[model samples]
Target: MQTRRTFAAGLASAACAAPFITAAVAQSATTIRVSTAAPPSDFLNRALERMKADLEAANVGIQFSVHPASTLFRQGTEVPALQRGNLEMCSMTTFEVAQQIPELGYFNRGYLFNDHAHLRRAFDGPIGEDYRKAVSSRMGIEILATHYLGTRQVSLRQKRNVKGPADLAGTKLRMPAGPEWLLLGRTLGVAPIPLGMPEVYLALKTGTIDGQENPLSIFSAAKLFEVSEQVVLTSHVVQPVFLAMAKPVWDKLNPDQKKAVETAAKAAATWGDTARLDDEKTIVETIKGRGLTVETPDLKLFREAADRAYTGADATKAWDLQGLKRVQSA
Candidate 1:
């Protein structure tokens, strides 16, 4: 009778442990790895944190492991890693995508977006959907959300005041090593010197480059004011970072899992967008407080130059001018 009682007890214990064991297995099976080139303090990283919190709160069995500041993959390799199925997700720039899909470079065109509202309409509307489709079909990556990085502006080292594009003529400016960026530098009347992001600080400090262009937040984050003497509010290019997942990984998600991820991604992007917009307002004063001269030139000249670049044959070769016109009108 004691043996039968013990057997009954064993069955009861097994039954009690089954749910726990199943949950553990489910959690282990759904681990996700997300990578980004942004530092831990960056808005992009903060957004990822928000995403993690939301996903976990939804009681999804998935687990998120974040790697920031290019820890998991080197700079410029994130996209390739995602394509190869070596990574689950990443925050990538449209410039990187433009290298493969040159037509996508249209979005990077100088002064294409009039303001944040215009940009939001274009991206959150049909243009965004079209680009997402193209990226999924051509690159095998699924775009979840678009997060604003910041508006690009010029930061100079020698206290030179730039009133217009003409003032930047022959000035050696650090630019990203991409065709569109090269063209932009040329259009803006600067001698374009291609450099990596990690090298910009040392390049400025050592006088390897005369100036560089980036949003105020990036300038402050890198503490570029220490080396930079002046800031020109060019607001040349409005950069948007893409929150993307490998198509293979995205395809494996069930409907509910996909919905959870999408909701989290959009929420995180909204957080990043709001944070960046707020930062843009205050970062200029913060930079000025550090003894850097700030200038707001007649943006008319720069805008005209940008318009010329947009309609040029080179730009037209890669972009759908009609689509661009539609975005502008929208």
Candidate 2:
């Protein structure tokens, strides 16, 4: 079996039939400072760009200035940037959100989401509404939409037959610098090293870490395929990132502006989600062409290991198990 993942061009709008908001009234442009660690090539960015196009075409007094690839804010800084009024929007990660709202950490747990669809179900429906409220109340951020990031897999610089969690023992794995992600490192039986995104490539090339894990879309877009020799498809986390805006900023918007933003976000998510799902279906072959060996590990073993890591843990004692159940059943 081949482990594989395209960001289809989503400039105008994503399969959205809703007519553009055509209010002819013009006001001072509200320039939203969008920042992301994702490259312009990322499907999320493409969708955001598409939303920007839709918003601009709507004649809404909105200017979406997207700063991609950490040009504006480095990884782990967007949340604060939003709070400080330095940034207007970003694709918020569960890992970062869990930092402040600890119980929300359940979303960061591996194997919790059956797939992208299940993940979205939790966020798009009642459970997602609950999450949005929690974030808005506790952190002052408003979630506009949720989009799929591909399933996570382990990409290593050295080829090894990784059939189970133990196979990765003592392997230094690079994870986002945080207690939560480091916890995931321990679950995978790896020596976790905390590093920023911009430093990963040089670290891999310099042997500072043995491997890293991310969605295949990220792996390909970052060109990690060029540095890593193998990909072990653990498929642990079916990741989803949120399109978010600062709560105060969102509140300050006029009714029509708010409607335009919401409409654009919805259109963007719909387009980006479909593109990402398609990318996951075909990306492995592209990486393999660059001389990477894709391996399917014992996924059952991996899932069981992740489940064991969270059970009866004091840190997760306050988690919303019922909500998790709802997401699982969804």
For each candidate in the order shown, give its overall lDDT on alpha carbons: 0.85, 0.85
The TM-scores, one per candidate, come to: 0.89, 0.89
C-alpha-based local distance difference test score of model 1: 0.85
Off by over 4 Å in 1: 1-27, 309-315
Clash pairs, candidate 1, are none
Write one digit per residue (lDDT tens) for candidate 2, span 1-330.
Answer: 122102333433543423433322323578787888886788878888999998989877887878878888998899999988888999899998988988778788878888777787777888889889999999999999988867888899999988899999999999888877887887787899998877888899999999998888988888888789999888878888889999999998999999999999999999998998898888988888888999988888877887788787666776778766777798
lDDT tens digits by residue: candidate 1, 1-330? 999999999999999999999988886657778888776777888889999999999877778877886788877788999998899999878788888888777777788887777888888998889989999999999999999888889999988768889999988999877778888886587999998666788999999999999877777777778898999998888778899999999999888889999999999999999998999878888888899899998889988876676565474487766876787798
Tell me the alpha-carbon RMSD of every candidate: 3.0, 12.8
